[model samples]
Target: MVIAFVISETFSIYSFNGIRIQAETWAEALMKKGHKVIKVNPWDKHNWEEYDIIHIVGPCEFLLQFTSSLVSKNKNIVFSPIIDTIQPKWKYKLVSYWGCSKLRLSCYNHDVRLAMKNIKQIYVRSQYEADYVHICYSVPLSKIEIVPLSYRISPCLHYPQKENFCLHVSILTSERKNVLRLIKAAIKYKFKLILAGSIDSEEKFRPIDQLIKKHNNISYLGKVSEEQLIELYSRAKVFALPSINEGVGMVALEAAVYGCNIVITEIGGPKEYYNNKAYIVNPFDIDDIGKKIELALADDNQQPSLMEYIQNEYSLDTCTKKLITSYNKIVSC
Candidate 1:
């Protein structure tokens, strides 16, 4: 089978581009399974008919035009929408009222609806996302497939001595990421916080830069490689991501596999993975976030080993098989 993976143009700027990572992983896995995979740039001209499947990852507003063009081609397109339902309700309402534009919304309302109508299959990371797509976009439940995100699990080479600070990994500039709120909570609780990932823009950088300077307990480690991230995850007592919107908190899953007690927001994605295992808190409540962080830090030893669970449920091999199964179904149809 020949497969083409497509992603938004802006994905290059995203430090933690989970969608791109997933697309590449899927391509690698399919290749190992004796399938030819090609990555197509969203903006580049391509012979769309050459591939058996054109899999588009992350259908945000940036890729709206590209997706619209793909839909018109009437090719067998599979989409991993990676939809997040935690956005403010007003944003949707604004899009509905004002219509599509580059300035107003990251994803145009009509583009999502049109893509859903034309796509061969819609792949989602969790049931939470599947339900959100069905409910919000009115996409049929039969069209949606729940395929959880996978992590590359390797044996810890040298476990670092555990540290007292809490670790967070995400782009701090995204409004939905809610890094500022986490910073405030960390300061309130007087807990040492280590932030990883690059700042998105100068506007978003200024406030966080000031916060780091003012608070001795908070440290920002610009952007770290995968190896360095794993080392940090191993060393940290707690890993927290208080995001208002998250597709599947991949960092938290990685942290959990490395044995850091997780304190994630009670959003859809993380809850599916960390049901009773990790501390879940409301992102909007600073007090709740602070309390949960403190609890996670204090009860690190009590947290169960997520290694076995992740390996069985969300390992690269397991998810790859699931994705292949979905692709086969689409191709056979």
Candidate 2:
């Protein structure tokens, strides 16, 4: 089978993007299984009908044009929107309006849902995203598939001596990541916090930079190397991501398996993955998030046995097989 993955054009490469990572992982896994996988930009002029499936990684306003182009040429396409609806519809609409007017987003809520209707299948990370797509876009439940992101564990990992600091990894300086609130929480609780991720812009980084300077416990590493990240995960006492939302919290899973106690957000599909091994907190509550981080730091038996469960369910081999089966089923029809 030949599959073409459509990459986003508008989003910058200056910051780390998990959705892009997921697409590349899936492409590598598929290629290893003897399928030809090709990377295609959304706006590129290429032979669309040559591939068995044209898989769009994430939804954007640019997708509306790409979806129409694919339907006119090939008609076999699937989309992984990664859409989650923790907010009420009213709030979502209000925020979408604000995004268009203030942030200059081309289109947010409506255009995204409209782009999925003509696609052959919709791939989502969880049942929550599947249901949201079905109900909001009026897409049939049969058209939505739950194919989660694969968590990769390093083959050459060595557990270092543990430290007392908590580690949080994400694209730093995003409001959606809620890192500012996390910083305040760390300062108030007097816990050592280390952050490792790309800072998107100097405008967004200014406030976070100031807070980091004022607080002795908070240190921003500003995007460490892969080796450095693994070492930090190995030595940290806890891993926390008190974000506004997450699809399945893959980094927390990696940290949990590496002997760091998990403290993650409560507003998404994390509960489905972490089960009882993680501490879930309201991302809006700084005090509560701080307390949960402290609680996670104090946990003695930090739930270091999640690796087997992840390998059995969310590993590259496990998810790639499911993805190929879905691809076959979609193309066959």
Residues 208-319 of candidate 2: C-alpha lDDT, one tens digit per residue: 9999999889998887887787788888989998889777878777776566778888887776676567788999999999999999888776545554455467778888
Candidate 1 at 234: error in angstroms?
A: 0.7
Q: lDDT by residue for model 1 over 91-149, one digit each (tens)?
A: 65345334445564444665676556568788988887877677667778888998888
Error of 2 at 213 (Å): 3.9
| Model 2: ten consecutive residues of lowest lDDT | 95-104
TM-score of predicted structure 2:
0.84
**lDDT for model 2:** 0.79
Tell me how far the alpha carbon of residue 109 in candidate 2 is from the true structure, in angstroms, after superposition.
Answer: 4.4
